[model samples]
Target chain A: MPVLHPEFWRLLSPEWVLVCFGTLFLLLSALPATRGAKRAIGVMALFGFAVVLVLCAQTLAALSPGMHVAALTGLDGQIGLTVDGFSQVFKFIFVLGALLTVLMSFKYLDVEKAWTGEYFTFLTFAVFGMMVMASGVDLLTLWVGLETMALSVYVLAAYMRRQEPSVEGATKYFLLGAFSSGLYLYGTSLIYGATGTVQLGAIRLALMDRLAHGGPAAVGFPLAAGLVILSVSLLFKAALVPFHWWTPDAYEGAATPITAFMSVAPKAAAFAMLLRIFVVGFLPLAPMWTGLLSLVAVLTMAWGNIAAMLQNNVKRMLAYSSIAHAGYALVGLVAAGRSQSNQGIAAVAFYLLVYAFMNLGAFGLVLYLQREGSAGDQMDDFDGLIQRSPLMAVLMIFFLLSLGGIPPMAGFLGKLMIFYSALDARLYLLVVVLAVTSVISLYYYFRVVYHMFLKEGAPNLPAPSAGRPLGWSLALCGVAVLAIGLYGQPFLHWASQAVLLGR
Target chain B: MTIGWILLSLMIALCALGVVLARSPISSAISLLIGFVGVAILYLALKAEFVAAVQILVYAGGILVLYLFGIMLTDNEALRLTRQTHLQAWPVFVLILVLFLAVGHKLYHSDYTPQQPDSLLMVTDQSQVQALQDRLAQEAAAARHATNPQRVARVLYGDYLYPFEAASVLLLVAVLGAVFLAKKEV
Candidate 1:
C-alpha cells in the first residue's frame, strides 16, 4: 500500500510548506501587479522561511531529547525519507542561510538594477531542494533533491544574464555539474545492482548480510567502485580539492548575495548528504572510505589555503577559503570514521553552523560595499575603511578573525572542536594539517584587515551606505560569531545530541 | 541469440562513434537518433516493452526533435568551424580502460549474482531444470495478468512515489530556469 497517510504528510509538512511558498513566489513573480513590490515579495519569502523554520524547530523539539530514533516516511518495504535531529539541524542551517541571503540581496539587487521576484522564487526552491537532500534516505530521492538544488543554483548563478562573466560562470558550472550528476546516477545504479536495494537502511542490511556470509571478499568490487564514484560527486558539490575547479570562478561570477548563499547553504547540504550516505549507508565500508577521505581532506586543506593566499579578489579568496573550511569539516568526518564516537559528527555540524555565520558576515560586508557601478570586491576597495566607517571595518575584522579561527571567536571554537575530535580519533597527521593550514589561512584573511585599517582610502570613493536589512544581517551574524564563540557548550551539546539521533 | 546481440551492439557502437566523429551538427544529431533507436531495440529484446516505447517516445521523438530545431535555429556554421580538441581524451580513455579491465577481471573471478529469482534459476544445477521451468511458467502467468504498464505503474506510484513527486518538482524547476534565463524581460 502507498504511504500517503496523514502522518506521512504531517511529518513532511516542512517540505510541503516550503514547496507551497516556493510556488506562491513563482506565481507572484509572474503577476504584473506584484512586480513592483519586490521588497514586499522578499519579506513574504522571509516570512515563509520563518514559518518553515518554526515548523522544523517544533518537530525537532517534539522529538524527546537524546532520542536515537528516526521518524521515517514511506510505504512498507520502501522507506525514502527520515526526519530526525541530524536532518532538522541541517534544515535549520539551510533556512538560516537562505534567510541571510535574502536579507543581503535586498540592496545589492536594487543597486545592480537586477531586482526580480523570480530571484526569491529560485532561492526558496533551492532551500526546498536542500531540505530534501538533508532528509532523503533513498539514493534516488537524494539524487532528485541534488538535481533540483543544482538546477536552481545554475539559473541563479547566471541570474544577472546581462553580465558576461555571470553567464560564462553559470555555463561552466552547468556543464561540470551535469557531468557530476551523471557520475552520481551511474554510481547509484552500480550500488543498486550490487545490493538489490536503493534505501540506505536496506543497503546496509544487505551489505551486512553479505559480509557475514562470505567475508570481505563477498562485498564485491562493484560496491567499491560505486562508493568512490559517489564520493567524487559529493566532493564536487562540496567543492573539495581536485573536484573544486569551478568554485573560484563560480563564486566570483555569481552575484555577491548568491555567492554567499551557495557558499554556505549548498555546501552544508552537500555535507549532510555525505554524512547520511557514507555514515548510514556505507558504514560497513568505513575502513575503505575513511582512508580515502583522509587523503582528500589533507589535499583540500593544503591546496585551498595555499590558493587563497594568491588571490587579490576578496570573493575568490573567500571562495578558496570556503574550500579550505570544507577541508576542516572533512577532518571532522574523517575523525567520525576513525573513532567510535559521535564527537566528530557533532564537530562537523557545529563547524558548519559557525561557518555559515562568519562567512555570511564577511560576504555581507562585501555586499555592503557594492554600489551602482562599483562591484567592490577588490582588496583596494577595502582600503582604510576605518577612517570612513569604523563600525563596518570593525565588524569586518571580527568576521575575518573568526574565519581565521582566532581565539575567542566562534570560528576558533569550531576549529578547536574539530581538532579535539581529530586528536580523539588519533589522526595525528590530519590534526597537523588542520592546524597548519588554519594558521596559513590567517595571513590571507588578515590581508583584508591590513587594507581596511592601515592603508589609505581611495580619494574619490565615498563611504559605503549599509541598508537596514543588510545591517541587521551583519549585526545578527556578528552577534552569533561572538556569542557562539564565548558560550558554545549548549550548542555543542545540541550538535552531539543531533548526531546521536542518526544512530 | 548471442549473435543477434553482438550484431545489435556493434550497430549501436558504430552509431555512437558516428555521433562523435561526424563533422556537421546535423549529421551528429542524426547519428544520435540512430543510436537511440538501437538502444530502444535492445530494450525491446530485453522484454522491457514499456521502457522501449517510452525511450523512443521521449528521447527519440521529443528530445531529438528539439535538438534538430536547436541545431537548425543556431549558427551551425560557427559550430562546424570550431575545432573540437581531444587534448585530455587519451588520458581519460586509458584510465577508463584500466577501470574496465579491473571490473572485468573481478566479474570473471567472483561468484556474484543479482538477487533476482529468474537469474538465480538460470544459474541453478541441471537437476533443478524442472523446478526452474515451473517457476518460469508461474512468472509468465503473473506477467500476463499484470501487464508491463500496470507493473511499472504499481511500482512507480507505490514504492517510488516520493521520488516520482520530487522528480516533478525537479522538472518544474528546470522549466522555471529555462523561462527565467531565456525570456526577453523579467
Candidate 2:
C-alpha cells in the first residue's frame, strides 16, 4: 500500500474549501430555518472566500521564489494547481470577483424573494472550477473543470425556469457550450496524436524539439488542424465575431445576478486559460496565431461596437460591450506574442480586473431599477433615472464612463495599458483600428448615459422600490470603480509582476 | 504485416464513410460504432492491445451510449430536416466547395505519407530483455531520463491504486447524476 503524504492534502486545500462550502450550503437550504439562514450562507461563503484569498496569497509568495512543485509524484507526476504569476493574478481576480458578485446577488435575491441556498452553493462551485481552470496545466483537467463551470452556469442562467427567456437562454447556452466542448475534445485528440502527450508542459517541449529539427515534424497535417480546432474552441469562449451568437441572448435573458456573474467571472477565467495555452503551450507557433488574433480582434471590436449602437435593451448593450472589451483584451493577447509578452499579459490582467467591477456595478443598477415581477433589464426602465433617483444616475454615469474608457475612470487606464502594449509591439495597423473602434464604442456607451441623465422622467414609470440596503450595494460598486480608476497604480504593479512570473 | 495494416486501415475508412452517408441518425450512429470497431482492430494490428481495448470500452461503449440517449431525448422538431430559408445558402455551399478544392489541391501536391512505427509493443525475448535492461541501467545513471518500463509498472501498481479506485467512484457519480437529472421532480 502507498503511504499518503501530508502535503498532498495541503495542495488540494483550495478545492476542498469550495466543495465543503457547497455541500454545507446544500444541506442548509434543504433543512431551512429563519430568514437569516439564507443571509448566513452568504456570510459563510464570504468567510470561505476570505480563507481562499489568504491561501492564494501564501501560494503567490511561494511562487515568487520560482518554486516548481510537481503534484502526485508517486502516481502520474501530474502538474496540478501551478502557482506561477499567471495563475496568482487570475486567482486573485476570480476570488475577488466571486465575492463581490455574491454580495450583489444577496441584495438582488432577497428583494426578489428568490434567495435560495442552492444558488450560493452553485456559485461557489463555479468559482472553484474557474480557479481550477486557471491552474490547470493538463488538457483533460482543464476541459473537465471548464465543463463543470459551464454546466453550473447553465442551470443558474435558467434558475427562474418558469420564465420563457430564462429557459430559452439556458437551452441555447447549453447546446452551444456542449458543441464547443466537443470541438475542444477533438482538438485535444489531434494534439495528442501530434505530440503523444496530453500534458501541456510536455507538449510544449515536444513541439519545441520538433521545430528545432527543420524536418517533416515542423509542419504536418494533424498539427495545423489541431491548432485551428483549438483556436475555434477558444474563440467560442471569448465570443469573438463569428462565435458570438450566444452572448447577447444569454446575457439579456438570464437573471440579473447571474448575468452579472457571467459577464465578468467566466470571461476572465476563459481568457486566463487561453493566455496560458496560446502563450505557453503554443509559443513555438507565435507567428501563426499572432496574425490570426490581430484579424479577429479588429473584426470583433468593429462588429461589437456597431451592434451595441442598435440595441435598445440595457442588458443587450452591456453584452455587446462585453464582446468589444474581449476584442480589446485580444489586443493584449496579440502583444503577448510579440517581443514584449509580459507587458501584453499584464495589460490583459488589469483590463479583466477593471471589467469585473464596472460590468458588475452596471448590472447591479439594472437589478435595482427592475420592476417587482419583471426582468430588471429593459432600456426604458432607465428612463428618467436622474429624476427618480439621483444616486442611481450618478452610479450609472460612473459605470458608463468607465466602460467608455473616459479619463479618470478605471476603464480608461485599462484601455491605456492595452493600447500602449499593442503599440509597443509595433502593431501600427491594429492600434489604429482599436482607436477608431473605441471611438465608435463611445457612441453606444454614452447612449445610456444620455438616457439616464438627460432624458425627462417618464410620467408612468414608478420609483425604484429597492430599499436602502440594495442602494448601498450599488453605491459601494460605484465607489469601487472610481477608486480603482484613480488609484490604480498599485493594482497595475501587481498585475505587471504577475505577468513577469509567467515568463 | 504491412498488408494486414493496410487492410485494417481500409476497413476503418469504409466504415467511417458509411457513418457520414447513412440516412437515419440511428444508422449513422451505428456506422460510427462499426468505424470504432475497425479502429480497434487497427490498434490490435499495430500491437497496441491496451489502447485497442480501451478504445472499444470507452468510445464505442460508453460515449456511444451517451450519444444514443441524447438523440432519444431530442424532440422531432430539432431532428427534422427542413429546407433552407436563407438566400445565402447557395453562396455558402459554393464557398465551401471552393475551400474543399483548395484543400484537396494542397493535399494532392504534398508528398506526405504515414510512417507507421514497426510495432507498438516491444517483443519480449531473452536478448531483447537484456538489451532493455542495459538501456534502463544507462538511463538510470543519468537523472534526466524520465521513466523506464519497470518504474512505470511499480508506480502504477503502488501509488495509483486509490485513483484507479476513485475513477470507479466517479463513474458511479456520473450514473447517479444522469439518473437524477433525467428524473421528474415528485
Task: Specify the CAPRI tier of model 2.
Answer: incorrect
Residues B1-186 of candidate 2 have per-residue lDDT tens digits of 888888878888887887766656677789889889988887777666767788999999999999899878876455546423679979999997896566434433443322221211112234753654475466456523443434444434443433333233234333433443343530
What is the per-residue lDDT of model 2 for residues A1-503, given as tens digits with 9 covering 90 to 100? 22355655565556666667776876786664666777788888778877877776666666534433434321122332354666767877887777777767766676667766767777877777777677666676677667666777777787766668877887898899889989999989999998876656556556655655654345566876677677788788878887899999988888887898888888888888888778766666666667778888989999999999999988998999999999999999999877534799999999998898888888888888876676667776777888888877888889889988898899999999998999999988888988898899889878887788777866967778655545655777788789989999888987875652223
**Pairs that clash in candidate 2:** none
lDDT score, residue A22, model 2?
Answer: 70
lDDT of 1 by residue, A1-503 (tens): 32556656666788899999999989988877543587788889889988988887776776655442323532113457777778888888899899988889888878987778889989988988998898888899899999999999999999988898889888989999999999999899899989877877667657766766886678888887887889899999999998999999999999999999999999999999999888777766666678779989999999999999999999999999999999999999988876767888899999999999999999999999898887889999999899989999999999999999998999999999999999999999999999999999999999999999899997867889989999999999999999999999988886775553234
True contacts kept of 2: 0.00
lDDT of each: 0.85, 0.73
- Clash list (residue pairs), candidate 1: none
Question: Candidate 2 overall Cα lDDT vs. reference?
Answer: 0.73
Q: Which ten residues in a row have the lowest lDDT in candidate 2 chain A?
A: A72-81
Evaluated on CA atoms against the true complex, candidate 2 attains a DockQ of: 0.10
Report the number of clashing residue pairs per model: 0, 0
